[model samples]
Structures are given as structure tokens and as C-alpha cells.
Target: MSHVTSPTGLRYHLTHTPPHLTAHSHATLTLTVHNPTPHSIPLPGLTLALPDTPTGTATPHTPGPLTLQPPQGWTTHADSPTHHTLTPPATRDSQPHELPPAGHLTFTLTNYPTSEPGTSTLHLTETPHPGQKGTDNAEPLPLTLTTWPSGTIVNPPTLNKNRYNNGDTATIEWEYSPADGIDYTLTYYPQPAGSGNEKNTVTYAQIQDHSGTAMSNGLRHAVYNTTVPLTTDPVPFILTATYQNDTRTYTTIASVGEPDAQFGKLQVTGHTTLLSTTPQTLTANGSFTSPTEGFLVCWTAPGTAPNKLTVNTNGESRTLSYSICSGSLTLPLAAQSAVSYTADGVSGDQYSVTWIPLGHAINQ
Candidate 1:
């Protein structure tokens, strides 16, 4: 038995000639290879290898080197039992023919056994023309063969909507039979437009019993909450669900057009008209009126401790203390009253008081 490997290149396709072949039956193996690079390359030779099964040994009958004519201009030669070579035909100019870029080559193995129900492999080795160098001398291209399956597999989850608006909740629903020891993981990738970065958020859940049956009509569901910050452009939400060796992906879009209107109403508030010189005395019990809702009293004082503000309202005096930093203090006024605010050692300080009416708290 041989270990089968996958093919590496822009695109490669391998299939059994008769779609389905029973064990010990003979079938043709076809391979199509696409050239992805810009420069023309020397085509590679392919070697087919099959697995040894209890029934019989899966063998490939090798064919002679292939010669292709103009418009194709390529020639293939079997260098050995397990090696083949592809090169441009010799020309009057004596130049080596090369496979055109983006072109494709199809090769077939006439009769190969299915021998066993498992995997078959095809190994491709490049036999360079006279003086070709670099990647042309790279490793062999390995491709695994796909066998017809015995039964049908369940399809991946499907979404009801492909697009959503900002703050929209998306639901992903899927149905599958429960298997012991099998768990599922769902991951969401939020890619903001023009951000050039993908953010991964993952959620894990165990497949639960639906109506006490391994397979049921009721499907499991998950929700993607998009209440947080979103991008300005359409955000792509990619969700991938995985269970053991099988995995599936679903994608949805969240379009965030013009900015949220509520975000624009946020701003700093206060009066800038009052300016006082340092050490200037405020008339004792002087009164300042604020908006009906309230206002934020902000001031800058020297970075020193014991900054004091005394507020006298209705003959009751209270002193508010401030620490070493300069910041703001909220003054909520419910009703009109003769309120006096006096600052000690904060005279001539640059201060601005912004009004914030009731019900205007940004977070609310």
C-alpha cells in the first residue's frame, strides 16, 4: 500500500475515467494540470502508483512517451518505468519547446486497477530540458486520487439571508446526526472593508440531542450578535463550522452605510464667556446660572493638592475637594436656586463649563 498525497500548483484535477469502479475492476485515470506561472515551462512527466489491497494489487500499465504537434509544440517521453519527461520539440532554430503559460496538459493512464477501495496517488516529476534551472528543478507534484463514495454525505449549513444591516443579529441554522465523541466549533471572521485585517471570533458548542434522536428534523442554530462597533463599509462575516475531519464555511455581509445618527449628537458642552484673572476675588456668594438640565464645571489649576471649591446654596455651605489633577465636576441643577460657587487659590484659571441636559448621557 502507498500513501497518497495532494497535488500542488494553481489547479490540478484527477478523476477515474468511469466515475465509479468496483474493487478489482480496471479503469482509466485522467489528470489535468494547469500552468499558473507567466513564463512558459517545460511540462512534467507523471507516474501513477496505486495501493495494494487484500483483493489484488492495483497496477498501472505504462504507455509510451507522447508527442504533440503544433499549436501544442510539446513532446513527452517515458524516461523510465516510474519517470516521464516533457519538452518542446526540436525545431529548425534548435530551441527547446516550452509549455505556454496558463496553458493546460491532460494525461491519461489507460488501464489501472481499483484493487482496493481506498486512495490512489499520482506523482509528477519534472524532467528539465537541457539547461533549464530554478523552480523548474523543484520537487515532484503529488496528487491523491478520489474514489467513488459508498454513501451520500450531508450538505453544509445554509443561511437565510446573505446581507444584514449594522446591529442586525444573524442566525445560522444547520442539521446533522449526532455522533458520540463528536463536537462542533463555529468561528466568525469579521473583515472590515479597506481595513486589510481579519478579526476572528470563535464559539464552541456541543451537538445536542434533538427530540432524543440521532437524526431529527429540528436543526441546531447559532446567532452572531453584531451590536458592537462595525466598519463604515460592508463588513464580511465569515463563519466556519468544523466537526472532526469535515468542515464547512458560510459567509454573510453587514452593510454600515452613513454614520449612525445618534453618534453625531455627542459633543462637549459649557460656557466660555466667564474669564477671571488669577488671585481675583469673586464677590462673596456670587450666583451663576446653568442650563435647566445641568452643566460640567471644568477648570485648570496648578498640579497641587488641596484644591478647594465651596458651594453655598440656601444658606448651607459645602466644600468640594479636588486632588492634584485638573478636571471637571458635574453640577446637576433640578430647580432654580441662589447658588454661589467660590474657588480658593484657583482665581484667573482658564475654565469652561459645558451644559449637559437630562437624558443626554452619551452611553444611555
Candidate 2:
């Protein structure tokens, strides 16, 4: 049930038969528009949207034959199966019928139950006239249509990789249609007791919808070392999907493969002379090693990144460039670990660049 009264004393009320809308059967709804203003106003056209069958098309949501049974002395017409428009009657003098003060009109609308469960709204506008064409009211009234699903098609969430390796990109996909609204959530479970990581569920809210193709914010790809703990073998990934005002929810989980990529040895170059052709000298600071040689990618100073064995400093702020090597390259030496990665791939220039210190970047 929904009703809205305008400041001008115009009121609209609606109620449907069968109590609630269901997919298995047809439904009849009663709609009433009342003019309570002392002065008679021109009759208005009632505009309503009907449900579109899951016809597989975005527009013309429905190929319907919606029926409108107006009360005695009233008339109505449908612009389209899903779009309905009701206008005022013609007076004997050919003048448009004016709704007298306190006068009201009622209508009974019927529609076969739609297999695809979804919501729609109803609204009203001024009836069109010869010189005064119909115009939408400044404020359109809304009446929500609630529905019950009999057999709704649901697509479960799927990840690109059942098992993920360090630096591996993961794509999450599912068939999604708007159900009042859209929602997607991804959660990374805490490490198993001991992995040198804080045991807490990490959640990301930045879900993107690429026509329901890829809906993730760099889950396994972005700085995998950190997003996915290095020590935790096979991280558990859970994704939940739902919609606004929808009671049904869908969720799934899969174990992501462990990460083997860790820093060999970090050699932090405290200083470097790049312009000279004779020979560039670099000064190295002692760095740490994590059990030596276990990695998905080996990065080198090929002028591809600043750390061609180069180090970044807030004090200097040089955008160092480095290169991506097929084999592993140790950090040689390290200071403190602070690293971050972008989702770009090794084939590209963004071959696992580090934003944090060499330590954290290597281990993570």
C-alpha cells in the first residue's frame, strides 16, 4: 500500500489485490486520484510503469498487454505494454473534463505475473490539452511496487583462479541484474594463527561493475605481498552479493593459492650518478634477506624503475625508474620495509613496482 497527498489537496492512493505481488499469478491493483481543492482542476493523466518480462532486452522491458479497467464514466489507454497513460474524458462541448472539487476517479489495473521478479513505480502528470500540452508535475509522486519471486534465476559468484600465486591477478564474475539496487562485497579471512600477519578479517568496499564482468578492487593482484599475506598458504576468499531491499543473499568462498614471492636481498642505493657515460657509481646500504630465492617475479634496475638498485626518500622524492627481469634480483640490502604495488602486469612498465620500503615490499 502506498499513498501520497500533494500540497494542492490532490491525493493518490494505490493498493493491490492478492495482498502481495507474486510471480505465479496475475494481480489487480486499485488506484484512486482525488481532487480535494475547492477549485476544480483539469483532470490529470496517470502514468505508471509495469514490469518487463525477462525478455533479454534493456528497453521495452515488457511486451505486455496490461489491462486498465476504469470506473464508470472514465476512460484509459496504454502507450506501451509497460507504460500506461490515462487521460481525462471529452465533454459534450468537446471541452476537456475538469475534475471538480472533491471529485475522485478510480481505476483497476491488471497484469499477468512476470516471471522475472522486479519492482516498478507509479506516478501522475497533468492531462494534455490542445493549447496546454501535458507537462510533468514539478514534483512527481512515487508509489513503490513490491513483488515476490517464484522462480528467480540466480548466478553464483566465480573467481578467475581457484588457487592464486603471488602477483597473480584474480577476476570475480557473476550474472547480475538490478534488483532495486546493486551490492558486492569481498572479504579476505585472517591468516591461520601464525603467518607473521595480523589475524583479522580484511574487507574491501570498492567493488566495480564492468557490465557484470570484473567486479573487484585488485584482490590477488595489487601488491599481492600485502593484500595476500606471504606466509599464509592458500588464503580464503569470500564474496557476498545482494541488492537493496532484497531479502535473499548469495555468497561463496574459495581458497587462494599461497604466495612464494619473497625478497632475496635488497641493495638500497643511498646515492647514484645517472648522467655520466664514463661510469655511474652507487653506494649500497645493508639490506635484509628472507630465506633467499623464492619469488614469482625478479625485478632489476633496467632504468625501468627508480630502484635499478635505487632507493626512494621522502627527503629527495625522485621518481626512480626500474626494469622487469625474467629472473630474480635480490634487494641486495634494505633499510625498513614499506612497499605497495599496482595492478598492472610485468609485460607492462608496472612490473610490480614498490611504493613501500624494500623490506615490506620484498617479504610481502
Global local distance difference test of model 2: 0.49
- Local distance difference test, each candidate: 0.46, 0.49
Lowest summed-lDDT stretch of 10 residues in model 1? 272-281
lDDT of 2 by residue, 195-310 (tens): 55534332323443233332243122211122444244454544554432333344545454556445688677685322211221221232222232222223443434333332
**lDDT tens per residue, model 1, 130-172:** 5556334556556654333232222354544565444444454
lDDT of 1 at 143: 63
Give me the candidate number with maximum lDDT.
2
Name the TM-score of candidate 1.
Answer: 0.37
Off by over 4 Å in 1: 1-46, 50-104, 108-120, 125-141, 145-165, 176-185, 189-198, 203-214, 217-235, 241-248, 254-259, 263-364
lDDT of 1 at 137: 50
Lowest summed-lDDT stretch of 10 residues in model 2? 274-283
